[model samples]
Target: MKKLENLQKQLGYEFKNIKILNEALTHKSTKMPYNNERLEFLGDAVMDLIVGEYLFKKFNKIAEGDMSKLRAALVNEKSFAMMAKELKIGEYINLSLAEENNGGREKISLLSDAYEAIMGAVYLEAGLEKVREIAINLLEICYPKIDLTNLVKDYKTALQEITQADFGVTPVYELTGSSGPDHKKEFEIALLLNGKEISRATGGSKKEAQQTAAKIALEKLKK
Candidate 1:
């Protein structure tokens, strides 16, 4: 239809087999025999490969672990959903009446899956090169808006790396105390670097408090 044609124009790849494109847009909620699930699965792998290769080449000097984190940040559901939203992909999805009423079009999971399915359809119709081109173009548009450095920084992991690299010792997180009622208890945690307390933070849970403390430690160490 007109909508499909417009989407094809937007994607810059006209499908030889429109059925595949239609399948990509069709949600499982429709209960249709042909849906996007299989395409989504294929696309997920394809995306991982493409993104991994991209980061590997672009950040050639970076370590494998750093590249992995960058790839994860780029290919996550939230990032895919943002790309889909930018493309206005939700308007073209074929959802069941119930799903439509429930605002399925705006659902991040649905949008991300559909975007992946569309990528799969593109790959099947065109080729890996063509799909890679499309992905790179989209990523180029998205990259400037993303904080690549922060995206790869897991507080605890960052703290550990810093401590080990600088002091030749690992960072440790200790639960210092807890307050409030049992159900709503808030935990206080401290980060220790080489047996010396570096920072402390409070959060609703021990893990959160530890992360906060780690973040604080990282900040202070960097400063």
Candidate 2:
């Protein structure tokens, strides 16, 4: 209860209905009668609507396909997980002993789902504008450069172009390691340039890990 109150302070939005807030932080792993599943469902819809509206109004001239791509890039597990990490949502979630032992606190999907439930709880209590204010602020802070070229840029392609121009060969991404359960595996990628490890990164998927490693390589190579 004290931690929940502190979470409110951290969120900067006090809840009139703390029950919803508690529900939002609850996971099904806890075997509770009322978990965050329903809240997560509501939050998922809320996130899409807010982001769709934001993109629509912000990028009036952009085509529908591009907007869809942008939304896809933003409204996903990886993105929300990162934001939830920032808010320390993982630390506050109610998980069972077995789930906790399995490192559910650090699980991206759990964090993502909890964050959605948080949004859902906020929206239910305070409406769209209030939740939008909170979500957009977090989005901008979490993703400082939120635009078409920035969000949709193919870092892997860009890295290849640079590598080819300089080394006359493209960089290679190799899976160095993987961890977590099968359903929530995190892939580790090593970006190799001319057979030397240039950078390494991890992500929810291989492609994501490769892209992230490529992005890191691009930055260092540029410098």
Candidate 3:
């Protein structure tokens, strides 16, 4: 009860219909009659438009393709999960005991979905304008210097360019290992240059691991 109040405070927007907020926080694993999936779908669409319009207005002279990439950069599981963490959404989630034991609260997909559902609930209850304000507030906070050049940061490509120039070889990614439940599997990947290991990282998926490893490798190259 009190925790939900704190969640609303964290969001900086109080919900007129608290039940809808609960529905948004309820996971399918709870076997509730009403879960957050539908709200997640709606929120996903809403966020797409919000981000699309933001990019459209922010970069008036940018091409359609570039705008799409920018939107893609922001509207992703990773980005949403980061925002979920910012709002501490995981703490308010209603998960099954099994899921809780499986670290559902920390799962990227779960957090991202909850974030979307919350936004969706907001949109449904208040309207697009209110939800847009909340979304923009979070985006600006999460990415304080949000801009075109830094949005779609392709660390893998940057590392490749650097390695190619110096070692005349591209960085290779090797899947080292994976574990955890199928719904929330963790993948470990090693970044290699000239058949030698440079950096290793673990993430929610292979692509995530690859990107994390690439980012780590890039940092190492920088120093």
What overall lDDT goes with each candidate model? Answer: 0.88, 0.93, 0.92
Per-residue accuracy of model 1 over 114-186 as CA lDDT, tens digit each: 9999999899889899999998888878776444546766688878888888889998888889999999999
User: Which residue runs of candidate 1 sit more than 4 Å off their true CA positions?
Assistant: 145-148, 154-196, 199-223
Model 3: lDDT of residue 181: 97
Per-prediction TM-score to the true structure, in the order listed: 0.71, 0.71, 0.71
TM-score, predicted candidate 3 vs. hidden true structure: 0.71
Instruction: Report the C-alpha displacement of residue 90, candidate 1, in angstroms.
Output: 0.1
Candidate 3 C-alpha lDDT tens digits along 153-207: 5688888999999989999999999999999899999998989999999999888
Native-referenced Cα lDDT, model 2: 0.93
Task: Kindly list the per-residue Cα lDDT of model 2 for residues 94-178, writing each as its tens digit.
Answer: 9999999999999999999999999999999999999999999999888888887678858999889888988899888899999
Candidate 2 residue spans exceeding 4 A from truth:
155-223
Query: Against the true structure, what is every candidate's RMSD?
Result: 12.3, 13.9, 14.1
Model 3 alpha-carbon miss at residue 73, Å: 0.5
